[model samples]
Target: MDGTLLTPPKRSARARGAVLGALMLGAFTFNTAENLPIGLLDVVAGRLGVSVPATGLLVTGYGLTVAVASLPLTHAVRSVPRRHVLTGVFAALAVSSLAAALLSSYGPLLAARLVTALAQALFWAVMGPVAVGLFPPGVRGRVIGALSVAGSLALVAGVPGGTWLGRHGGWPLPVTVAAVLGLVSLVTVAVLLPTTRPEAEPAALGISPDRRRFALVLTAGALSATGAFAGFTYLVPFLGDVGGFRPETIGVLLVAFGLACLAGVSLAGALLDRSPHGVLTGAVAVQATGLLGLYAWGARPAAAVLFLVLTGGALGPVFMATQHAMLHCAPGRTDLAFAANSGAYNVGIAAGAALGGLILPYAGVRAAFLAGGLLAVAACAVLLPGRPRPAES
Candidate 1:
């Protein structure tokens, strides 16, 4: 036999690209499904004969489940094959979405939402590590950036898509569409993803942290996420109530914000490959500026929209940088680090939304923006130069 024949056949680049694409698409689909509830709160409340705040609990419940489930699930599945785990999670998501689509009562719907959240936490907790394993170190940031774009697209498309479906065919239509997308994702992962297990160092795969560095990064990530969510959860109301934008106009503005985020992630990926530290610092500062600008210009529709878009742009880069930092800080413990970051992000979302809710009833929607700005500034302070100790081992 020839020497070439003795060597294993090289995997085709196209095949690898397909796998990456599928993974990203799956991530996008899951996030879209998770967020669909946000746009449909009013419709769901009306249909279930519940108050709007009660309907909002669906979001809270899902987020809380994700926050609690990600780390433990990551630890439990550390030794499993990545593709198998992804396929299982996708299958779970599809099942949950179908259940939600079929259920008429609030209790069953809530259960379905919780299941979806569980699957989502599992998927996201694994995605970063899988992406890193798929590519060479040189291109890892770019690969991550590409995935971020797909996720941002989901955010941009999912809400409007869900809203349109709800309007044309009612709430169940959007949930059904989400389920169908999850099924498609399941099929793609099963067929396309590689079955081989990568040999990762034990340290890189665990939830136990390097202590000093992990704490600093986690704290920064949580605060930054809090700031972003504070403004984001209340975006529609802020645009409509304070900026005097119509509901249609707010929707259009949100699309603009999503586009800006797509651009930010793309730009930041290139920067991350060179200097993640600079990108992190600049992104945090810009995000703080954008939030404060929104608050300052709350009365001006044009200016507030401009600021909001800038804020979205800043958000993607900052998040990507923080995530990259966490992975680097822990070296061999990427899954755990990422899961911890995801938890922090979810915690921030919950905290920000709760804070926004508290202020909304008392200080009005604009106060939410101010709160977000303050949180961003605080995150920046925590992550500033010469503050946190370097990673160990």
Candidate 2:
């Protein structure tokens, strides 16, 4: 047996699961905090005495910070204890949430969002590799699948939950609750995560990558993200203004989409171990089809809901595929790979939201979906010809 396998097997499994669960909860809270403003946009806009476009600055600012911070933070903390770093990141997020909750003015709120974005960047930068490290190679996919499932549940639960809470108690209440959850996650990480370093030492896993391949993967990830979020960011308005669904009903539909994504992520992980590129290519195509279908048929409530669920399901494999590609591009540098991917994802969020905002003023929600479809198709074009084969660890 390997020396690293000396710990009690049952205790070890439970500890690893708990750590993953905690990380998932952190991911949930981070996303919830980031997106809560989306569902409550009108309310937030009115309260801050600003236009919807101004309020959107909150999202854009947060995304930009995350995009800029991921790589540097990953490099700076490469040798730190995983648990310690996780705890610190969550604690910072909790502080930012508290600031957002307490402040009533726009400037303070924007500043608070920037702080949360930094924490979120660090949190995601650590999660992928940490999830991989917690399990032996034989079960790596399953462990990551479980982590993805937890994140999916959060995506499904967080937005609607925060929206409902904000509706009932005001914007600050949901943010406060998110802060509390961050604290809880912090405690969970400190207690459950084992003390471990990266299997490949920091020096050995050189943080640099071939510039050409790096740029390609990064561009592909950003384009794919742009496609995914174009429709997603405007989902609530589309359901309400176009599809004639009530807010509560829209929430339910969003939850359903999230659950579908959870299922997709689980299935994708299993399939990815065998043929990652094929899975990713299929996912992108399916998502593009779903986005276009929504644009064409979204006026009907039932059709809109069904197509949204399909879109979410198709989205499930995209992340895994992107991560696989990044790691392959830089086989030894897991931290840098994840950081680059995380940055691309943030850029995607910013691009998609900005595009949606620009189009929603004149072209309507359908136009946003069309834009997303075009981006997805572009991503497919970039990714298909140069798909890298899986590298042996």
Candidate 3:
């Protein structure tokens, strides 16, 4: 037998759990590294003697690379063992992070960031199918939910912690730790992931697939992301100007919002398998309600906090459910479809931020939340009425 799985399901529950944990660690590390620059833009800029805007390119550029390269790279390695491919990617990410730390110049570090982005492209493409493959199909929703939780942790723990370290110790310290974390994930996955024959049917491919439903899933995903980020990108400005929150208290609020995100994904994992589309529609509705409520009531501090947390709660599930739904609804190859979804999500992030920026100059920050709320509502519209439900794969 091929080695994609190391043991029979009945015997390897613990082993499967351990491997899933390693995958979770890798997912956390990759997501953290991708967004870490945002929190440390100024710190990184000062260390490299560049402007903060220039340092911000590290993030925007990385997203561009991943969005462009995800499908091609995922296709190229279609025949490789996932265990091998993922471990290689982790090794590459580790090297790139180390390169960023060692190189002082902006040009060199930017090159390193691109390498990390390339690795991340393929990592996202495979990680989902791989995670679900470890468990029985009945639990796929829960599997995605668990993975999304690790990703959410990156926002609350990894990004914030890196920012704190950079502010105190230096930028390179967090960058180096990023490398260390990548290496740790690399070793763990290499040891635990099962070996496999290259010719074996991929565990990650869609079983009961649908192109129309898949298109609907992608549309809903991109729209929801666009809506959420439009508001999220301007959270601080909205809080400061509308909610009258102080800088110190905003951090606490953010931490609370992050915790709410954790709760969202956890609930999604519990309920997604039971009714996938229903959860998707409901999450988007909840997100829209929060944004709309924020736009209408954010002038009051207590109401602002409540709606902000409500939106935060839905944000994690909105996108998490998108990818989970994709696992069953992929139009073609699951990995390739995943690549497309990742690209769309990244595009959504860029679009939402750009749109919010444009709105801020003309309509004000409150208008941005209103715009976001409308888009999320539109996402709900995309998921319901005539949309065909996909069969569980």
Candidate 4:
């Protein structure tokens, strides 16, 4: 595991820190690009002279692209060095962001977004395994959690900041900033990250390699994600329409929701190694409770906010636990397994939003919460049959 021409050499503490920072920043930047359109929807639509709904497809299209491409691209890169491959991913993100910034037409902008999505496909599939490879196996949970935190910040900080830029400067300004962030991450990673060997260490492979357990992880994670985003996608409108909160208060509430997510991921990080199954079980249940609660009591602003935070809190940990389980129970190549998990997750995101959209007109936005809650509860049932065995080393 020590120095080789291809594999990671002995890493200094500082080098490892730099490497992780690069990866985390890469994650943050990619996610910001992915979600930035949500904040810039109206602005982008107006500038592009398109319908708001058409402009919103940037997010949906991006998720679908990642979902469809992750496995194939991960397979395609199987023979390549991960560090070098990841550099390409970052480079693509930069190029795609710049294209988004420059494109005058909606069709071209969508194309640019999808290009970034393709890079993200490869990025998510590789990042977890690569980060796990760098550290001692004992702290893998924390590592994954930290990485998820970087992503969650895309919701709290990155999107809002981009929104500010888009509002003040133009839609392209935030997209351009994302391009710069991607370039910075690309350079930092290229310079600092130690090269990893092509062959995985036994420690790096799944401990159990159970197809059934791995399926459960993906199924449960996807279900909960579907449910969470169902309400989450429409949450702002729900708050305004149902909860009667002012615009300024809703912004504050969003920050609280984001903080709650961080709290959940941090707690899961501490507990995941000890109880991966338990952590997942608890998170899905909390997810169900939050969504169901929202459906039942969302008319009351206090209860609505409380359940919203609860939903936010459980959301990050659910995916964290899913990735952790995938690492432990993958039936084949760990990277491929991670790729599948990432694909499944994006499928959930796209499905949840679409489902919410379908249900919103017919059943009303509150019904989305019910559908999501039921899905999370079903996820809980999925976990009951059997779970991944913890490593006994």
Provide the TM-score for each candidate, comma-separated: 0.89, 0.84, 0.94, 0.94
Q: What pairs collide in candidate 2?
A: none
Query: Cα lDDT for residue 70, model 3?
Result: 88
Tens-digit per-residue lDDT, 239-351, candidate 2: 88888989889868877888889888888878765676677787888788888878888898778887888899987668766765554455446666778788888789878
lDDT digits (tens) for residues 313-345 of candidate 1 = 988787677667665665355777778788888
**Tens digit of per-residue lDDT, candidate 3, span 1-393:** 222223233427777887788778878888888898888888888889999999999998998898889889988998898889989998999999998888999999999999999999999888887777777777888998998999899988988998888899987888899889888878877887777643343445565577887887888888888888899999999999999999999989999999999899999889988887778889999999999999999999999999999999999998788888776767666778888888888888888998899999999999999999999999888888635555642
| Residue 35 displacement in candidate 1 (angstroms) | 1.1
RMSD of each: 4.8, 4.1, 2.6, 2.7
After the best TM-score superposition of candidate 1, give how far the Cα of residue 161 lies from its true spot, in angstroms.
1.0
Q: Which residue pairs collide in model 1, if any?
A: 203-332, 204-332, 204-333
Whole-model lDDT values for every prediction: 0.77, 0.77, 0.85, 0.86
lDDT of 1 at 5: 12
Best by lDDT: 4
- Candidate 2 accuracy as TM-score: 0.84
How many angstroms is residue 324 displaced in model 3 relative to the true structure, after the best TM-score fit? 1.2
> lDDT score, residue 111, model 2?
93
